[model samples]
Target: MIDYQLDADGLATLTWNVADRPMNVLNQASIAAFTKAVERAISDPSVKGVIVTSSRPEFVAGGDLDLIRNIRDVAQSMDCSGPVSRILRRLETSKKPFVAAVNGSALGGGLEICLACHYRIVADDPNIQLGLPEVTIGLLPAAGGTQRLPRMIGIKKALPYLLEGRKADPAKAFEAGIVDAVVPSSELLSRARAWLLSAPAEAAIKPWDRKDFRFPGGSPQSPGPIQIFFGASGALLAKTQGNYPAQEAILACVYDGCQVDIDSGLKIEQRQFARLAISQSTKNMIRVLFYDMNDANRLAGRPKDVPKRSFKKVAILGAGMMGAGLAHVASTAGLEVVLLDVSGDAAEKGKAYGAAILEGQVARGRIDESVRDATLGRVIPTTNYSDLADCDLVIEAVFEDRAIKAEVTRKAEAAMRVDAIFASNTSTLPIGGLATVSKRPARFVGMHFFSPAEKMPLVEIIRGAGTSEETIAEALDFARRIRKTPIVVNDCPSFYANRAFAMYPYEAMTMLAEGVNPNLIENAGRKAGMPMPPLALIDEVSVELLYKAMKQARADQGSSYCAQPQDAVLIAMVEQFGRLGRKAGRGFYDYPSDGERKLWTGLTEHFPRAEKQPSVEEVHERLMYSQSLEAARCVGEGIVSVRDADIGSLLGWGFPSFLGGVLGQIDTVGLPQMITVCDRLAQHMPERYAVPQILRDMAASGRTFH
Candidate 1:
């Protein structure tokens, strides 16, 4: 995989281009080839220095995750990480200057390799990111990243990149001393060669390898670093809530490694990496966040018979928050967007929302003023239905009411091309029911974008009974174009993500009605790795919205409706106390203009605390199992596939990635163990804790979701 060539000046150039793969990744086969190339260059008498670069778009994507995913023991973990570490160490300490000519993004093992070289010079491209981001996928940078990065920069500077898995573009990387220089793509190779040729023999030695080298920041024993370590530990625990072991492991690697010699520090890093490699958390993350997520993004569930389609123009009906956000994303993706509402003024206000966001991006230096102006210029705000006539797709982000949605659907369809697709951005209403109003039911579909569509990554593409394969293909294509992960589901109430996620907040309210302490309930949710505590999430989403949805469901189902225990709590909060939500600045928590929100003291007056409280573990399990059980029911009912269920849970509702997704949590907890927990929970609330038959069958058959 390594193409080795010697120049007239005795400079050896090793160009990495793995023939089979699009990007050069560090794997057994490629590592072995690279080792041979390094050995040949070092042993050859004619070679004076070496330059490493890649012919692919990316220098190296990272380690082969397939190999890391299969690592089952410490020995396998060491074997997976050790060889590359050894090879890189040899390259850096061989007394031969090596320069890394980074042409594109270099992350994890890719950045680790760059750190090993005597000097790193990257192409001056904003898209080129360089960082050690292994912690994000549940492992530390095993191949000498933890050791070398801290030495190259400092402990304080390196900790954020290593712990949080932050990436820096070419300019930021140069400012942070992660790379020596940044040059144009065309001059990358020549610049690397020039640095190698002009460097003295002493330049071959790394700072840490020299006996007199001192760390840029103080050592671990110094007051500043010790204080940083203290603060970082507390911050890590607070941020992670102790759900992720990888962060703790990374903190230990840097703190423990940097105090000793480079070789000893590397061994410390490898040992920690081996422990995390075979961790259950690591496996779950790699499976759901990596593998399953990749499957969803690639449109794995799309009908194979239909060819891929593209959208040139899309019209969004209603210029509220959701509609405006849709316009922003579509226009940003280079599609002409018609953002329409009832009046011209309303539509113009919606367009201003996108403009404000673009202005912020320009101020942050994230985008140039030219790019901002061009992107905003593509969104045409108007009240005319005739504007959608030439559009390939029209998505209505109107009111959740069926009559209002049906009205917009009929109007948009009347003004659009015959073959163009019509989509409703409804999260709860059944897509098939909504399609009944359309003259062309085959073209009617649901494209459910979460609130603040520009930020949320998920788009649940609901396939109605009469929806054509071509319509589904086009919907998936539009989701991809806007950079959202689309999960296709058969039509049903609340759909997959909302149906499964609703249980989370409902269970918390159930406990509140049972006299469980509100603080305890919120803490348990956060401790379980939920992005927001149940009460806080409810407040943010607005309790008024929840009450309305509950009332609507009751009206629709009539006598067949099954009222949850939380219904009483919702009624008392909204009707009895008139505490609408955060929007009203009065809900479960009392928001102040001058201070951070605190739990309303009147909560206990209404829902008094019980004399005895449940353990935190019990509360945590109740919250986790409630959501996973509903996800299992979705799978059993054939509403969603197993992979989509997991991916949707993650990207849709912020189900903890470290636990995988909801289904991944079930698999990790073991089918039998999950059933056992559910059975125990069912003793209290049978309806809420009812286990799906799919879990039992999988437990009996020894099957896993992954």
Candidate 2:
């Protein structure tokens, strides 16, 4: 309902409160209500000023995303422009000052609504963000925003915001001309009233409509903007690699809107926005990055229902790369950390890792010198177990040996408080076995931080059979506190990601044995959207680790490890030839500090390049699909943590983020088709490429991986 109240000062306050919703959103009902309220304020001579506010936590969130998602017909979507722009035009034309008081977030159409008003005053709530982020979701501002925002802020500044689709902080919003002022929550209404009272109680057409308004970089009569439109179109295609459609749609809307009158411009916007909203890229982006991602992070599978996780000090038990990175992140998050190792020098080396990273961040302007110093100061290094006595959590990121891990677990358990959590960073060892070494097994769990923990986001929290609910919740909370995405997984081989991911390198190494050029196989991996090809990935992992993983696979899989043609080749290289890997400057590739990484040319005589060029498609499938099929089997066999399996793949390994997750990629490409491709290729791929039962079931039921 369009309810309006006018005070004796001739100031009319129109409040929007959508029933059964926490935030105000623009939809047909709200738009209709807005039109009615605006008409009332315009017709009443008693109303000298109009105040638009929300009676909810958020001033205005945006348009209903579900409504946008259903807009498949571009022409029908275009029709929405007529009434929307008409109301905005009418409100602008009303001979009364219109001011918006944003009590919370003002985003998308919400921000567009504020742009239609004369001025905006926003609450300074830290939770509040203000911007037009339509581009990121595969759409653009359609309700006269493309036309108005640029007119207010100038083209260059507005273009970056529209293209990138980032929500700005309140202060940033004010500075960027998206909002005029920011006020604290308690004084939001009074500050808004003061501004409204001081503003001239009259309205005029916007500065853009003035006869003398000249768009910067272009005269209204010139071809300058035309050059920009064509230039920007090319740049968008180049940067996005034609992988996204939002940038093109945004550019098209703005270019057309700028040259036309406001009435006709709205039509162009609605049409482009609709087409973009339904494009494959946009649909996939919203499903993966927004909906499913939110679902993954919010899941609570454990019994804890723990209210809070308290940990003021953290102790890391190993001074290796993973342990040092854990110390860095913990200290940076305002937790006092003690880095301990077997000896004093080892502990000192771990502290150096934190110092090196922080110093570089300071140099790059990512963190100030004081912040860097503060972070480094929080991480105290020592070899003494006494230093870990008061620590609330002790994480051991050591080798994968079961014996070593069990020993470390006992030591960590003994050093910390009885209630403190002891986490093992062992990727492949049985967490249950390690927990058995602890007296308080309920307080022990697995906090598997991927190598280079500071950079990687996902932390796989493995719940040991005896781990307490409180321990799991506290570990998950600790991961979040350090700005990481954490997923809870039942302990099993590889947990989820690395276990399935190790298959790719094995497949690539197998291909190398079949006379495929090592570089060609690696190049195919990269073209398939992997950050590194298998050989390069193996080098980064070190040759000794790959050999150990292969050995483990052989022992576990038995018949599943039935030798493919290339398995014999890697086995011979690692066992018979004594050519370990990058350490020896040889393996599948050669490396020296100063030279370009190239395949060992001499090995070409030993393993010749294949006479036939396998299509990049064929090569990518053999390498990537083998791992995906194994991942499906792992999921079916309860080796993976369900619900978040795909996100785990991306963060644990470099599974492509654009594909959403591994299963999401399968769904996007059609799981049935993927299964068919894998099955057909299995003839030559041995056990690695064989389609798993899960894929077969999904194919039969026509179900997606999600």
Candidate 3:
């Protein structure tokens, strides 16, 4: 709802207050009324100046992300674009000065409306973040944002923000020449009024008004833009491996739009918008990854009546890679982390790791020197459990062995408040076993942080058989506190990402067993544009650790983790010869501590008969398929919510981002086609190649992923 009031001074204030939402959303009804209001504001001569402000707690949030996301038809896309363009064009062509008073966030279409105004005045507060981040929803800014933004702000300046989709603060937006000025929240409306009344009432300059205004130095034809575009395109391709269609369309939109007239550019953007709208990845992404993840996180796996717990201090046990990285993230994100180890030196070493990362941030000017120091200071290093006596949560990262983990749990719980949650950072082991050692097992839950915790976004919050609902909520909260997305998975070995991901490298090696060369699988991973080749990843993760996991698997899964028949190269290196892994300086590839590690020539000594040759596609499929099929099984068995699992893969493992995520990859792979391919491989390797029922049915029904 809106109220238009005209004062005797000839200034009109149009206040927005949506019926009940905390923030305003541009829905069909709102857009329709908004367009009418725009027409009226432009027509009335009594209205000498106009200021758009919100009566709600915050300003307009954006177009409802779900609305445009669900409109799968071309005509619907056109219909949606019409009202947006109409309101913006009316504001642009208005005779009187038009201004926006942004009291809070002005995002997506909300920011677009501000851009359309002759003047935009934002409140100078940490809360006011403005940006045109339409790319997140698999769509570009269709309401003349592509045309007007480059003209309002120089193309070079606008391109970075638009192309990468970043949010800018009010001061930065002012410097970039996007917003007209910034003011305090108390005076935002008053400031907007003064600007509208006295500021150069020069009718808003539209991009279409000028011709020959060359785009910021990087015109597609110019060396600057050409190099940037092509270079960026190549990088995008490498990062996505041609898996995501959205980036391709986004690139095309910016390239074609900037080169042509404003009208032509809009058409290009609109066409791309429609095409992307109907895509399976787009819909699935909007539903599962974006919408679903957001909703689930807000729900936080707790009863609506439960009072939320906020833990400001967390004590993490052990100072290994996971423990150190966890301390870094926890400290940096405004939490006090008590890092404990067996000795003071071990605790300091973990603290040093956090210090190094902070130093890097300082070097990049990402944080001030003092802030970096203060962040490091927040991480208190100690060798005693008593240091965590008052801490709100204590997470153990000591060992995977039941006895060691149970001992750590008892010690951690002793240091906690009566209700302080205790969590274990175990990857494959069951949480129920770990919970048994806790004085209050209901307060103990599994908080499985992926390796290199600072870099990975996923933290599987496992709810064990005896874990309380409150414990699940607390772990989820703890994961968020450390800036990781938490997926509340029911306790199981390997949880989600690793459990589904373990077979990929093994299958790639299996392809090598069938006479495929080790180098062939490695090159296929590279040529396919994977972030890391299978062998290289294995080495970096330390082949020795994988060998340990395999030994553990032998006991749990009933047999040793074996490679494919032709995988004699690794089979001999890890199995027959007992050379162990990276720790042993042996394995499929040899690693010498003093210098760079290289592929061992000893590989030939292991596989005597198999030839070293295979196509790139074959090698890529072996690794990608195994992962994809298992991801499908996880979906079929409902181990994780479909959207959360896909997001987990994209955020957890380096599942080629261009595919959007794993489920997205399945759609792109064409379920039926992939199933047929799997069938062929199944004949030779049944255990590794069998297609999951989801994929088979998707293919059989001619259904696409959405």
lDDT of 1 by residue, 319-433 (tens): 9999999999999999999999999999999999999999999999889999999999999999999999999999999998999998898889889999899999998999999
- In model 2, which range of ten residues has the least summed lDDT? 200-209
Sorted by lDDT (best first), the order is 1, 2, 3
Q: Among these predicted structures, which one has the highest TM-score?
A: 1
lDDT values, one for every candidate: 0.92, 0.77, 0.75
**In candidate 3, which residue pairs clash?**
240-658, 243-658, 244-658, 513-566, 513-567, 514-566, 544-582
Give the winner by TM-score: 1 or 2.
Answer: 1
Q: Candidate 2: what lDDT? A: 0.77
Compared with the true structure, what per-residue lDDT tens digits does model 2 show for residues 553-623?
Answer: 67767886755454666676788766567767776677778897787676688777778867778888887
Indicate the TM-score of model 2. Answer: 0.84
Please tell me which predicted candidate would have the highest lDDT against the true structure. Answer: 1
**Candidate 2 positional error at 79, Å:** 8.1
